[model samples]
Target: MVFRIRPIIGDSFKRKERIGNRRARFSSLLALSKFDFEEEHEMNKQLDVHTDTESGLSGELNAAISRRRLLAAIGMSGAGMAAGALMSGGIGLAAPRGSVTEMVYGLSADCGSCVVPATIAELRVMTGTVTGTAFYVTDSGQEGHFYYDPGDTSSPDDTGLVLVSTAGYRFKRIYEGPVHVKWFGAKGDGSSDDTAAIQAAINGLAGGGVAFLPSSTYIVSSTVSIPYPNVKIMGSGSSTVIKAAAASNYETMISASGLSGIEIADLVVDANKANRTGLTVRTVAILLASCTDSSVDNCIVQNTIGGGGIPGVGIALGGVSVRCKVTGCILKDCGVAGKAADGVYTSGTQNLIMNCIALNCTDTGFVIEKSSLSGIIGCTAKQCGAGAAITNASAADVTGNFIDGLTIYDWSASNTGGIQIGTPNASLGALLNTRVSNVTMERVAGSGPSVYARQQGGKIIGLTLENIRINGAGTQGILFNATDILIANCHIYNTTNAGIQSQGACERVVIEGCYIYGGSFGIALTTGCTGCHIVGNVMIGITGQTNYGVYCFGTGTNINCIMNTIENVTVRKIGYDAGTLPNVFSSVNAGISTNATATATALGTLSRKFQIFDKDGGSIGFIPVYSTIT
Candidate 1:
């Protein structure tokens, strides 16, 4: 009778017990009192028990005598009541009779030999490789299939089991199944058509499915062709509306070309535009052309109908659309009057327009054309005609935007700024490496320029405007004509003109930590400004009809606005309300108004550590002026 079952540590049955020295510990009551079984079934039918040799009784004493005759035919007196009847009645495979009957047949004393699945359909046919601390499935009919890890005792025999199924889980297969655009006959009842039944249920989605748009109003009459690839067009949030019957033959009421893993969430794209009166062309409610990795979350692109005179874009990520995303969307009243409506339009490249909201647009309420490394975070543009328009973009990142009331349309005398960038005609290009941070423009009434940077035909290199906050600017509240520009920590107020104006042909300009009030020149650099660095600025209440808290001009014959550096500037109550007598520094020409000691030979390398005050705290000392004017 062969019997070899050694590895036992705790729960010692004391079979003459001598383990550590390797050997002796096998006596499940002397191997079930010497099990015989028809003389070992006639000596195992004349030996050769499939040749792993040593037969006759060495299948570990015939697996402890067939688990003591199946625990004495189920009366269960041993092997821990036959492993509590195979773990509360899911009794099936049984062979363990040692190591405390292999921990009652669920085998997992810290993964010594791993095989623990009492049920959940035997943990889904028990495969392997499961780690610790995260395994759930309490069998409400195998709820979302078994998952394992209870502090995984590592030994899934080297990475094997993968059985993970989600998204309407069924496990082992049926991975992503749920297409329902009313099961392909889509009649969300706002009129019927349902655009070929929601484009044939998004072309019968098979790759990572989910077309579902169930809560009503989907009368789409025309364009609805989401090409393909990993589609997901879920809705029901804003009651799933997708109106827009035929607003002029449809330039786009929902179109996704080229293709990439697309997604259009919680829908509502009305684009009714009062029924496109006469009709012409240019229209859009949601158009992603030449798409790539798309997404349009919490969607709602409103009334876009600018036909004939064209111009309506209410969400357009143009051809060249790459890395797209338009979050928490809501673009209103798209375009009407002379039609140039833009409420979220991107020429596309590394796109992302976060927390979106663009209202009353006719032109520019977020339009980053000719994109490159794009971004417009925490967005909101109101009463638009221009509230974020970055043309010929490059490395753009307009942050924390909140522009207001910028609709000064007289058919374009140019700069309708609440934030408008380049292209007066350098052949239309160049907004290079831009960044306008923490932007906030308020009450900006007509004439425009609450931030306008122009460099006719390319050259706004490495521009930056930080922590900006402007209130009531009708003209020039920060208008620069680029070249390595940087205006830091700005807070301009009540500007009628020049609260910050660095004219064209500018170079290496840097206006630091500003806070100007009632502008008519609280900082102006003209005649082709050169290497300027006006530091630590703070000019208060200069109501003296605007003269200067810092104004540098040159061209009294070729100094070409020399190297300027005005330091530690602090000009207070300058002419205090038209009483006239406040000039901290003004060097003009051709209508002459000179003082910097008569323009100090055209002022180059003029470094003034300035301080001019009034309103009863009189102090004016500005004599540190260096010269290098050529």
Candidate 2:
């Protein structure tokens, strides 16, 4: 059917034919635009539509009415009353407020389903239903669309929609792109000071964004501070270098202080230790202070000098930082000082240091101090003064680390070891519940042990050392002064002192399933040890030396070493060869001495009886009652 639309007061009428199989279509004469209705049954017939020049229509313009008569009939009396009655049925001719029927203009081809709303309320209703669908807004002085999802309405202040646009969409919100350091006037020419320019670029990113560094060397005179949350500073792997201009002035090259959700990746930080002319204080390459959920990955930190009564550190995470990670980074020549220069030092709770390498550090390659529930995994420490140090830490796991060629620089007997766990001061508290597993140490040449655990001020409790291999250590292979400690599944060889030694007051220590060879003593318990269980251990003595398989002795004072059980231990080639090693088990003390000089009357009251056995499980003799111990 042909539909005729005429204004109630004007004499102009427009007739338009409906499309095939379509009943009627609504075209508003007020805007002179036609709306192709998809659902024709939803539209109401006999509705009085009003235009801009007319008040209302009296009668509907059907097939029987001409164009001029239709306008004249609508201009008769009672037209407004009839139109009011028709609008009372909720069939108001004007489209719902802000609903559009025209094509949106100036939209790109990639902008899908451009929705141009005449009012904001129409846009809000459309956005609520179009969840996960992107739309472009055009012809409304806006450049982008309002992206919406119902799940984002969890916050009371959230509008469930975010307006992303570059040309200042709704309320003049400009989209923030990546903030490059070069855009902020940073000259990365390896000469000028780009510290201020780099800092400005990071500061300009208010609510956190990427601060990209190009492939150029940036000379920084002072420490660059990353104070913003959720900010990432990315660089071109090793090509982008951040070198310290003055090494002695700053404590760290980059400092992330009290910030969370920060990431620093693919950068090289150089401390310039060789160029230290007026260097005074020690330096750290990267310092993460009280930062949580932060990461430093694929970065290189090198040449940190620690001298003149100062300790240098390559990377330090202190101030109780939580859940931070440092992975896939290389640290070299970190500690120039011979004592306290540590490559990666962490005192943060629940932090992770993995897949990192520390080369030629003076003091220690990695250190976990006063941190609880932290982990050091899959790291390599080579040619370091000490491989790793764990002190005053609880519930920490040190696993899968390869420590090789640990040497002594200044030659302090107390401070040299491949892996050392000691409480040097009382302020650091006790070290408890620490586990070391699958750690291999080779060529540990120093005046100290391969693995040393000493109690200077604090005691160690619940320590576990498992699956460890120590080859070629200068002094003792493993030394401990701990309570409730377990050392199992270990292979120790070529040590100057005993393979495993326990000094001081050690209680409830278990050493089982260990193989020891080439040491002065296989297992030695000295200085008042109690309730130690040495079971299922094999000790093989090297030729051309006097070595004891198991040695247990007490101090010359009143402290007695008692209640020690040694069972299923195999001792081979001690005195069987041409060496002058006395016995397999050497018990020398005032009370339990097996020496022939002690009189029978002196041994009767003080000495306790111990059964000695041969290789064929035959009872050889008793200690202090008979001459032979084993």
Candidate 3:
């Protein structure tokens, strides 16, 4: 049954073919030389056909048939109405190999006196532009895709929504899915302003969809905002980046403002601060403002403009934002020089910043201020002004904020050091229950990263600083001005000042189960401090300092020092200021204690109250309650 394939509609369009075990293969006909290959092949194959539709062309066609004659007659004479019906619009054209196929791009060849592709934006779509609808049009007279939002008030040129010189097509009435930013003309060349082109893709998402950023570098001059809810824009990891333009004052590179369910992931944002000379206003790399239940994950953000604080501080949840998430991000070199800016800052309630790292920031590495019930966990900060800060000024008490598994190291003496919980305004009400635990600090400087809690202008109702370890070189140690506080299981070593100091008006503060080493005074009770109990501690003092194990100064009282071991201390184990009140002590011992006016044998000259015994069941000596001279 030798079947004949009627001569291909035209002859000039070369159609290459190979025949094997009942299979007909045709080479791409440069797109325009289109054909219904499946139907034509099936029909021909059913009849045991061979490659006989070979011909040569010399004449031209018209827009009446896709101009270049892509609409050339698919002559299937008697091949059945199925083939005929397919040739008409009843059957859709098969999609090509690639989603995007560029053809006859720039150079203009004439089609009968009219410059080919005088304007692609003005090309009449097979289906004219309609509201909130997607239509297929010719890509500069080839093939193209575009959707219309007649209500979109943004400038069309900026959006690239109405494209100019390009070529591609889409299957008519196909299911709409995530659109690529490049489809809207994003060059991603790392230089061209592709912000509008990319934003156009996001805006034209029909109704709440995703915009994919391919593995390319897109330069944005301003923030790419997600104004509506449930909009997601993602990229191909580090290979895909959105960079800030030179000298452009961008509040945020990518922003989700007043919208929820937005996701920003797997991308890099370069703020380009080296060239941002005129950037006066604050800068943020990415910000979710007043947005809830959104997320920013696995993003690498470098050189974020702090705008002195968060509008980003790299990535931020600002503007009453709540229940959002920022996780697995690396922030580097954020904040402005000679000014304060944080790596990650949030004043939003119930948000989370987890497993994130901040490096070389000018201010706090991560800040939770005036926000309630938020948490920062498993984070690290290096070379920052401070590791983390939790403060409340006036905007609602900073209550129930928690920081766990934080590591801060490598700070300078000139910087404000360590983790701080303070009230900057000093007038706010009780900042209730802020806890910092499982913290490790190494090579700390600038007041020695002591987990300082300076409760001023108001009161810290409940502060818990536990399971802290600070070591290897610092200027000072932990300072507390908080009330109803618990400082337990802390190991602090090698500070220039006292290991632990209580200042301001502190009450019911318990410092126990701690190892304090290498400081002038192991514990100092200072002005407005009272009701402090220091128990079960090992305090060691370095050489060349007064080295009192416990020293009270200024105005404080009701201090209890019990079950403590002091070693290598020069001054008395428990001493007080010349005019301060006497402190109570019990079961306290010292390895090497030097009292200014007393010695151990002085007990022989004073009245004896008790006796000490050796391990061999022998009476060692008589002990006295008061022995002053040594």
Candidate 4:
């Protein structure tokens, strides 16, 4: 009875195995490749005698010399150091799949990346409880993203740093504390002096904080109000920039009256000089009067003297600032004298402007006269001249703004009109309940699918427009006069004319779930339009090109092109392609009788059931949504 299997240089042993009677298994092998010393080294060196009937030939010569030394050490495998020690020994690496991978765990991928790995948990400092987790990269390219641990110890006292990003990161903190002001660079032409270091940080604030501007180039002058209350005047992110001095004078680089929880992140504010009317002029780059809880996120606000014209007001919020919030701000070129420049001139009332962005402005990209229940969300305006987006004398609550090119009043030197509500000198009367009522435009962006009302008898009631998307290759999405409208789920594409065009006098109107593809004329309802309701909308046609999806002219009465859906809409009942002639009180009921025989061989006409719908609602196929009309 003997047992032995050797190749143990500097011996080491431990063994156990059974199989049929219940238990079995043990393991150990360090260095034995060379195909197990040229194949099993003589049956593991003849397993020299040991006992229990040599334990089955010493366990089959120690398992064929550890399976030929693990297939000759699989070409010397180290498998990423055994997968970094089973991912730092949590065994087979599993956790981290949600909550932004359990709050940004590992994989340094490069510079300054840490999610706690003991430098004493990377500088831990918590009074009692320690609920730790962290993350924030959010497109961390351009050498940006950097968090502080400094070996934690609660980052130096008083329960400070509380970073909780992870909602895909929106960290633009731009300084939470510690950075006692000191930057001197771009003065020469940009203008310096910092007015005695901004009046010695507003008289050495004993309460409110922040006033950092590191990267330089800050030529400011005058109206820089700092009447305390959670003050902030930061920079550095856009690499610290602020230039305001184009002479014509009406100064205001930064102003805040009797502040209340304020904020003005990052920085830029270059009001391009030379008659830059109110360069950073006394109302707003970041102004909040009777301040409640203010904010002006990100930052840009440009117009540094271009055509000796930027009187195009940029940010002017007057007294009684309510929940003011201007997110992701950026206003460009601004009103080069074309007339009343405004990139944001509010009167503050329930203010909340989201994702703000405006380009080439002359007189509009957010200019609410006497702001009421304000809320202009998701804004963007390109080219812009007269009106790329406005609401004169109050009725503010324009939703999702995105105006495009905008040619301007067709060819009358001064006229852009893409979103203007009320103002032919307002006051159609009702004074106490005030003027300009509930205005809501969802998914808004227009060029054509129009809605331009000039007060004669002002009262825009409740205008709720869902999905009001217009591209305007031609014009008209919702153009009105004396309006009271409701346009639903609209999507007006291409266009040359008529998607929803009313001349004046529009009441109780509702155009539903629309989609007016390629227009030349889709829904015109002209002539003192009243009681309009065109439901489940959809209008197409643009191939060989011809128009008219729902056309009504002068002297309208309860205009209802009901439960609609027009595919190639070319039934121009009397005018349009064949010149112009047919115009009596147009009327059409439920449709699709070849649109009443193409309106009787082109307006020598006939009418009955005009373009069908309502087999139980919902069928916005062709697409012209006057707010889901039905």
Candidate 5:
């Protein structure tokens, strides 16, 4: 629905004139004409009533009235149309057909061709299409890849090809026609110079194709770098090996900077020699920084230099930007005593660590820090010193990882947790929202508790545990202290203290549908914490000191506890304060509500509980603080 009005100029209508408020006038005239009739009837028939007062004769008055009526009707219908013959000097208006909509105007110029007004010009529109390449390396080396040297042009290898061009320059692939390359090193075998060939191959190729390395051992001395956009270094399965010699000058085997769309896969990397100068020159394996859309997959990286007082990493990335993935790889014997860090350390954005293995690391098996929107899935870690995993200063999606023989070093250090989250000294903002926001540990094997996360600076929010199985442990099965945690459908037994512990000022904690046995405290909630709800938890064993089927502390009038039972509840000498109930409950076995008062038949079913006098609660518009155990 559009509205339009135009001005007419010259002798026929005289000076051009158009009312700025034509729409309002048109609406007013229309309402006046259809005061007692339905809107549909006005469209089907004419009113046949005179609207002009100046005309004397009946015919003139009728024509003027009919013209005004027609103008009003056209203004309502042709709301957004362009001016036609009405824009010319003559007021020659076109009569409308029953249902036709298009309007055309033809005007003549004196001693010249007919000219169409700018307001009456026809509109035309056009759309363009864009072309692109579907697949890379298409049609052999003729169309997709090329190599040319202007300095040594025996004749342009004019193969009638559309060689991949960038800024009007040609590029070449390494394996197309390789003549000679130096030999450097290989893995397992004491001597093989396949390292030099690998480096040359990587350096020679255009930054967009794949370099294939057949099964062989290569001894490497110098570091090799693969840089920029869509490059891949591949090997013939895991049989390909690259060994690094012991020397101070030896640094990173494969490193990158400011790159994108790269992949390195299927190989073994070893640094076990005694003279191992060590990765001191950046001291990292497979380093990537400020890069995106890159990956390392199906490979083995191991560092064997022990007691160098330096930290070595199997696969480490730092401060990268986006989309870096590490999958289906192995990191073993990576961290030596006094000389190693984490087996795999990822600190970046949108990174993924999936289906990998870590073994015999002196430090942490896998550590993720300061990352965003990342995930770790279906990995396994064994015989690690600290633990299988540690996450801080980031938020990650972690699931389906097997952890065993954790906390192997210093059995007395209670700080070792299988899947530890949050730490004491970590920055509050750094550990802002970490702790694997949503996780499930299904059918995982280990000798320790499934998960343990404690926060000191900031609390972990929105932590969920589902279908977690714990076989053996010395401490609590799943100890979590943060804000808003949920543990459901968990079966915990064997050696332990508390199956699930929430001891802090944490708020909104829920433990439902859990089967717990053989723990000192089935579920412990203490400290100055408030707003806790524990319901539908099943505890099997009924013997222990200070045992509680469902316990809460540091709560006042606003806390709730309902629908929890113990098959065998131990009664200790220490008396517990089961304070006044603030929630509405039907009976002992029925459900309850968070909005209830003590000694009431039903909440909010009676008169006011209390009245406000001279003192207004606290400062202003306030309520008194609730007790911790209510």
Candidate 6:
């Protein structure tokens, strides 16, 4: 039982309101004053209140009050409505039945005088049967797509309902989706120039609407920008391809600027990098400039150039974007050398870059710099000049990041970078509390290490590297210069110098449960290092030039070595030379002694035990650091 406040009269009620040039008569309002209480009571008595059909609202309405009382109350309410309408301008027009109508086929060009004569692809405009006063275009896709002359200044109540002066206007399915490009006369064939049609389809949508592309190849010569917020452009997986036309000089295929909730996904973008030119111009397949809460997912963007904004990116969330993502995309052959190009570049806060593959990029494969609380997960960068590069470029120190599940391979021999966090001479803020785990970096023909964390100005505090595998490097397998670091459960091999090396001053370094092999030095700490705990690590099989297994040059104090295994080294296992050494030193593993002649092994403060202080805070014996007796 659909409950509606309709007058109980044989003649329907009507209510009329002027909508721009057209009008709507609600019909039910005009019959309100003619409703009779006795007539309504008679009609309600025959409703069969005991027979519960669907809603069972009859039982509720019938039992709540007597039919005579209910009908009398409705009659009084109807009289009040009539009095109110008379007070407000008065209902003067003759109520026509229904001014709205739907039609299957389109209308002819000369159907009405004031209706637009343009061709109607689907729904046709109809002339008003009653003296050409009312106008309506019924059929449209997505329930609310509209067509109007751009010169019409007055805004209508509904976007779909634009009633002009007459009813002869032809209906055009302006692009709106769930807005499909096909509805806006975009021929997705390879030869056609679908730039204007696709652009109009995007512009037709209101905010927070989606524009969909079916499985077809759409060729375009210019850029298509999404200027509205909360708009999405989607495609039918890989079969929906957007390819650049021959000699297309557009800087970008698709772009959006400072819009939120914007997404570009499920499409194949072929930038035609071979035919594309302009070495000085930056090129991209999809660029989301300074847009927040956006993403580009499940896309294949290839043959793109980088030269536009320092580092050309296949899909970029540029200029301090926040909470954006680029996932499941394959970016290849982007950026020429010295142009600062990259795949999936984002300079934002709290963004996510995951499961993307960047191959053969001329510069960095993936770069997420100047970001806070952002991460790159399960991404691979292969055969690029640089791979998986990131740094904190801001002045204020920030923290909380995870670089996990990243695999980088075959960094260029000329470039000294692979999975790098911070440069040695960078004038930036500290990247603190960062974790790099489950990562694999390999360089078969290169001079640089697999992983490098070198910060010059601001310190990298509280860094953790675990479950990592680094193979074949030039100097060290991992160049670690961060403070308060932990390198645990890692396998590093085949380096010219040490497996894990720290050049400059570092503090509180811990190397735990790691396998270090085929390098000259297993763990090398040089100059101004302090508070190192080398524990439970297996260092064996020194390759190339035979050197000490674990070397420490100038550890100021407190360098503890416990349960560390070393073998196959002619030099001393644990070597510490030079620097100040006046405190208690302990016997370490078998390696090179301090210097050539091996005087007393001096390890500034190799305190294997802790001191137990008395309650009086004086004269307490030390609690031995290492529990080897057990």
lDDT score at residue 138, model 3, on the 0-100 scale: 33
TM-scores, all models, native as reference: 0.31, 0.61, 0.71, 0.30, 0.58, 0.68
lDDT of 4: 0.47
322-433, model 2: which lDDT tens digit per residue? Answer: 8998889988887654534778888767888888888887777877777777778888888788778777633333222222222222222346477877676655367777
lDDT of each: 0.58, 0.60, 0.65, 0.47, 0.50, 0.65
The collision pairs in model 1 are: 131-152, 132-149, 132-151, 132-152, 133-149, 133-151, 280-308, 426-456, 426-457
- lDDT of candidate 5 at residue 66, scale 0 to 100: 35
lDDT string for model 5 (248-316, tens) is: 356577777788887777878776534564445434567676679888899898874334465567776
Clash statistics: count for each candidate: 9, 0, 14, 73, 26, 27
Instruction: List where candidate 4 sits over 4 angstroms from the true fold.
Output: 1-223, 228-253, 258-286, 291-313, 318-342, 349-364, 373-382, 385-417, 420-519, 522-530, 533-545, 549-557, 560-570, 574-630
Ranking by TM-score: 3, 6, 2, 5, 1, 4
Task: Mark the 10 consecutive residues where model 6 has the least summed lDDT.
Answer: 54-63
**Position 573, candidate 2: lDDT:** 25
> Model 6, 48-83: lDDT tens per residue?
332232221121111222323322322322311212
Cα lDDT for residue 168, candidate 1: 19
Cα RMSD (Å) per model? Answer: 22.0, 17.6, 12.5, 25.3, 25.4, 13.3
The worst-scoring run of ten residues by lDDT in candidate 4 lies at: 17-26
| Off by more than 4 A, model 6 | 1-176, 338-340, 413-416, 423-426, 543-545, 554-556, 580-630
Native-vs-model 1 lDDT?
0.58
CA displacement after TM-score superposition, residue 88 of candidate 4 (Å): 95
Off by over 4 Å in 5: 1-189, 192-195, 247-251, 273-283, 304-311, 337-340, 386-390, 394-413, 430-450, 542-546, 553-559, 572-630
